[model samples]
Target: MEISKNIRESKKNILLLANKKNKGHIPSAFSIINFVYLFYENKLNINNDFILSKGHGCLALYSVLEHFNYITTEVFFSFGDFDSILGGHPHLRKNNEIKASTGSLGHGLPIAVGKALAAKINQSSKKIFCLIGDGEANEGTTWESAILADNLKLNNLICIVDNNQSQNRSIPTPNLQKKFSSFGWDVITIDGHNSNEILSVFNLNTINPLCVIMNTKKGKGIADMESNFQEWHHKGITDNLLKLYIKEIHEEAIS
Candidate 1:
């Protein structure tokens, strides 16, 4: 549950920044930060490669990178502007910390597939982790890459679906684990915001490629946003609302 507290604090910060920037994608960002924290903290080998397919969730990545001292708050101040390193989507060239230039939905997995194959060819110990959105699974390219990952038997590859249960237009996420399992992936489901659960599932060494479906709330941890996916997904935080959010988050974090 402390992981949830950490997640709430990070989401609160990201939400405040997003609101100030007059930008969107806060809910999506908040939903995945716990997974990011899990990987960056213990699951992932950062010396290896990671591709976040849902690049709109860059805030999640940004927060982890900052927490790890990879980047500073000054860099995030220019977010949403054309000249900033922090953009609407993640650009790999701008930050060596990021393994892929991702923004187009459904591209991370394929790119990660290539990265995984390259590592295999080079006989490198590096593994490729791809974080994708559940809604983005609708893209045909995602499934195509899944087949390749299985056919290649890329045990070096790991895919995580952030099953936030909503995307643009606030649509419900269809059952993705069954879909991936039908494609021959060794699939497991877990609570997305629970770090311990995620770590346990990832530790399981399934010789085949693995897909961990993270069942998550769209706006996890934020009171006004958690269950109200429609309004909170991209809604800007007003000055008045931000104060209330901070106070509410403090109570939740301490309680």
Candidate 2:
């Protein structure tokens, strides 16, 4: 499949910003890049809400929004600078595109459930889309939110887990599909990097809330960081490594 120019450009920009700031969850951010890209590009409906529950992955969200002019290059590069609106984790007021302030694991899904319930009570057509990390799923609050969402039959709520499987701790629930299905959710597991399969899930019509398990690599594009290397979760990018990454990404874009 042809990679979109916007995706290619945004990814390059994201890496450059990471190098400049010298701090970011680059692995976590890269893992979810495709999810954010496809959602805004194809699955998002106007007035619908989105939350990057895994706040460390905000770079991916920021890059996608910046690609569409929702944010500026100045603000994007200002990430992690003292008092910058953009921080390591997402801040709601940072930009109009960001729906919730999240960095704490397990907070996003609950917030999304609340939004979905509120929309349902108001009889609005809006849907709430939230992206969580497989690591974040280890939190108890995540399961609580999942149960509540299903109990209330919040069909408008869509929770997607970026199952990169690179979390620092042992996975609390190994069988994600069975866990969600046991909670009365309509679960779909797909290759997180595949745009086609990711886009196809949006067409699914189900009575229960949707839970998509997106299997993805931790540091997807860069060969050195492609797996769950704990260090890559948040590491400084040296000048040489940055050049190498840029070269690899550009070559991959063309090939």
Per-prediction TM-score to the true structure, in the order listed: 0.91, 0.94
Compare the candidates by TM-score and give the number of the best one. 2
| Candidate 2 per-residue lDDT over residues 93-151, each given as its tens digit | 87778899999888999999999999999999888989998888888998999899999
How far in Å is the alpha carbon of 204 misplaced in model 1? 2.8
Q: Which stretches of candidate 2 lie over 4 Å from their true place?
A: 43-45, 253-255
| Tens digit per residue, CA lDDT, model 1, 1-255 | 666666566667686787688776877887788778777777365667778899988888887777666788777657777788888889988888788888889888999999999988999878788999888888888899989999998888889898887764655457677888888888889988666787786567788888989887776656678878777666677888778877776666321
State the RMSD for candidate 1: 2.3
**Candidate of highest lDDT:** 2
